[model samples]
Target: MKAPDFDYLRPETLAEAMDMLSRHGEDGAIIAGGQSLLPLLNFRLAGPERLIDIGRLAALKQIVDGDGFVEIGALVRHCDLASSEAVARAFPLLRQAVGHIAHPAVRHRGTIGGSLAMADPAAELGACCLALEAEMSLQSVRGQRWVRAVDFFAGIYETALAPDEILTAVRLPRRGPDSVQIFSEVARRRGDFAIAGLALVADNHMANPRLALLGVADRPILAEKTMALLANNMAAADQAIELIGNEIDPAEDPAYPPAYRRQLVRTLLRRTLMELLP
Candidate 1:
């Protein structure tokens, strides 16, 4: 089905986009790469009265290295992240996650901000951001604010973003020494939405690890309990699987049953931990 009729505005600057979003309120939606939103529009799942396209807003398209973090413009595409040497060095998990997003063509057109804003529970980007403990930069006519990844995702296809707020950037902490990262997922086919996924990051010296699970919950979720288990026995693979299956709530869908998903999560979590351990 074709999308419903709607007015379109391509803003050249952040100020212009915010102004348009403020005026339109919930009737408007921002379009970055249009990879996700366009499909929703075409299916009539989303029929915003106005589309404020910020794909050309240069201010929201930059990737800057900071003292302790990297600020990535929301409009940066998956392909950009995959090939960026800076991103690769600072956050290899992000690079790995983006490469698994969909396909080369989709990665070329799908923006990091778009994927996060879409908030698909099965998307690798969402899981990676949570695993990295990234922060989201949100803007509105009133002002700007930052929301941590743990707080950004509310539920399935839901986010903490206000109707008038546009996600402007993602801030990721710089990698520390002895940091090991792993990302793995099980999809029915290459580039398909994952049936189960896991992203893990550990700093052996710090003795802290972040475990994030996807495609098994209402939203991408950080497995704090699993992480706690890792602190005790970084080599206890079975413990990691048990914690993930017992603590995390797996979603049941036509694609997979809850029991099956739990088992897949166990398998993926084991795989992720093995890759992250020495």
Candidate 2:
């Protein structure tokens, strides 16, 4: 199906884009990489009155490694993040997870900001952000504010972003010298969206582990019960594995039932723990 008729506005600067957004309010949809938005439009899932193109906003295309953190601009492509030396050194979990996103052609055009803003329950980047405790920068005519990854996602295809705000960048802490990262997912095929996935980061000896799971709920979620159990005592792996079923509320899908997803989550947790703790 073709997209409905819409007014297209291309903004030359970030400020201009924000102004346009402020004026259009809920009637406008911002398109940066267009990898996600185009599909929604093509399927007639979204029909904004005005399509605000901010793809050429150069200010949101940088990868800045700063003191104790690395800030990735919204327009940074998935493929670029996968191949970045700074990302590899600081956030290996993200670099590894990007490989599971989709085919190369999609990755070449998909932006991290677009993925986060879309708030897909099964997107790898959103889960990685949660594991890393990344913060998103949201800007609008009203002002700018930072939101933690855990609070940014509202639900399936929804976010905390106000209608007039744009997610400008994401700030992620640099991995400590002794940090260890792990990423794994279960999918019907390579490059397919995972039925369930895990992104974990921890200090050496698996202390202070942060485990974030995707495709197990309405949005990517931190396994707080599991993390707390492991944090309190690494020996409680068996109990922590059991806690996941209680923590996650996965909806039944036609292809994958809720029981299957819960089991997959358990298996992922078990495998990850064995690799990290054994």
Candidate 3:
């Protein structure tokens, strides 16, 4: 189905985009790469009076390397991240995960910020950002604020992004000297949504372990208990798996039920520990 009648706009600057969004308020919807929003619009799931396009804003397209993090612009595409030397150096696991998001065509058109803002449960970037403890920059006409990845995601298809706010950039932590990262998923097809996915980032000695689990809940969830177990003692892998199996609250689907997904999660967790732990 075609999208309903709506006003289309392309703002030249971030300020202009903010002004348009503020003016339209609830009637406006932000569009960057249009990878996520266009499908929603086509399905009639989202109908807005104004479409604020910020794809032309050059400032939002920049990638800056900071002392401890890479300041990745919100408008950066998935394919761009996959090929970016900066991204590879800072977050190689993220670069690998980006390659698994949908297909090459989708990656070419999908913006990193758009995927994060959409907060899809099975999205690889959000889980990777969480595992990497990335920071998101939220801007508005009022002011700007930074939100941690752990707090930015609210629920499935939801985030801390306000009606008048825009996600400007993401601050991804640079890989440390002893950093070890891994991403794995069980998808029916090579480019399909993951049935169960996980992203893990930690040091060689299991210090500061960060594990993010996806496709088993309403949001991409940080496995705090499991991470704690890994941090305290990697030998408690079985116990941690049991804890996650009990904690999982996946939506009931006839084909892939909660039990199956939880089992997948357990398997993935075990495999991750086995491969990474010395």
Candidate 4:
């Protein structure tokens, strides 16, 4: 099915785009790469009155390296992130996770901002964002504010973004020299949505770990109980693995049941800990 008719407004600048969004409010939908929105539009899942196109706004396409974090502009394509040497050095897990986002064609067109805004429960980037403890830059005609990755995701296909606000960029903290990143997912096939995926970032000894899992809950979620266990003592692998079931609330699905997902999470946690801890 084709998308419903909508007025298309292309803003020449980021400010103009925000202003348009502010005026239209709930009636408007922002379109950058359109990789995520177009599908919804085509399926008639979303029927906004206006399409505020920010695809040509050059300001939101830059990847800036900062003192302690890398500010990746919202419009940066997945392909760009997958190929970036800077991203590889600063956040290798993100670089690895980018490889799991659809195929090259989709990666070439899909934007990081689009992925984060879509907030798909099974998407790799959202899980990576949580593991990296990234911050999202939200801007509107009113003002700008930063939301941590943990607080940004509200639920399935939902976010903390106000209708008038746009996610301009993401601030991903650089991993320390002693840090290790582990990313693995169980997918039916390559490029398919993950049945269960884990993104774990921690030190060599598994201290101060940040573990986020996808396809096991309503949103990419942090395994808080498991992390707390590891932080308290590095030798709590067996107990931490058991806590995975408590931390995540995976919905029952015909294809991937909650039990299967819980087991996958346990397997991933156990396997990664073996490699990292000893």
Whole-model lDDT per candidate: 0.87, 0.91, 0.88, 0.90
Give the lDDT of residue 53 in candidate 1.
88
Worst 10 residues of 1 by lDDT: 269-278
Which stretches of model 1 miss by more than 4 angstroms? Answer: 276-278
Query: For candidate 1, lDDT tens digit of each residue in 123-152?
Result: 998999998989999999999999999999
Per-residue lDDT tens digits for candidate 3, residues 203-254, read 7677888889888888899888778877846777779877766677889999
Ranked candidates, highest lDDT first: 2, 4, 3, 1
Q: The CA-based lDDT of model 2 is what?
A: 0.91
Give the TM-score of each candidate.
0.96, 0.96, 0.96, 0.96
Candidate 1 lDDT (Cα, 0 to 1) = 0.87
RMSD of each: 1.3, 1.3, 1.4, 1.4
In candidate 4, what are the lDDT values of residues 1-278, reduced to their tens digit? 99999999999998999899999979999988888899899999999999999888899998998898999999999999988888888888988898888899999889999999999999999999999999999999999999999999999999999999999999998877988898988888899989999999986677789899998888999988888888847678888988886677788799778888889999888887777754
Q: After superposition, how far is residue 60 of candidate 1 from its true place, in Å?
A: 1.2
Model 2: per-residue Cα lDDT over 63-179, one tens digit each: 998999999999999999998998999998988899899889999999999999999899999999999999999999899999999999999999999999999999998878988
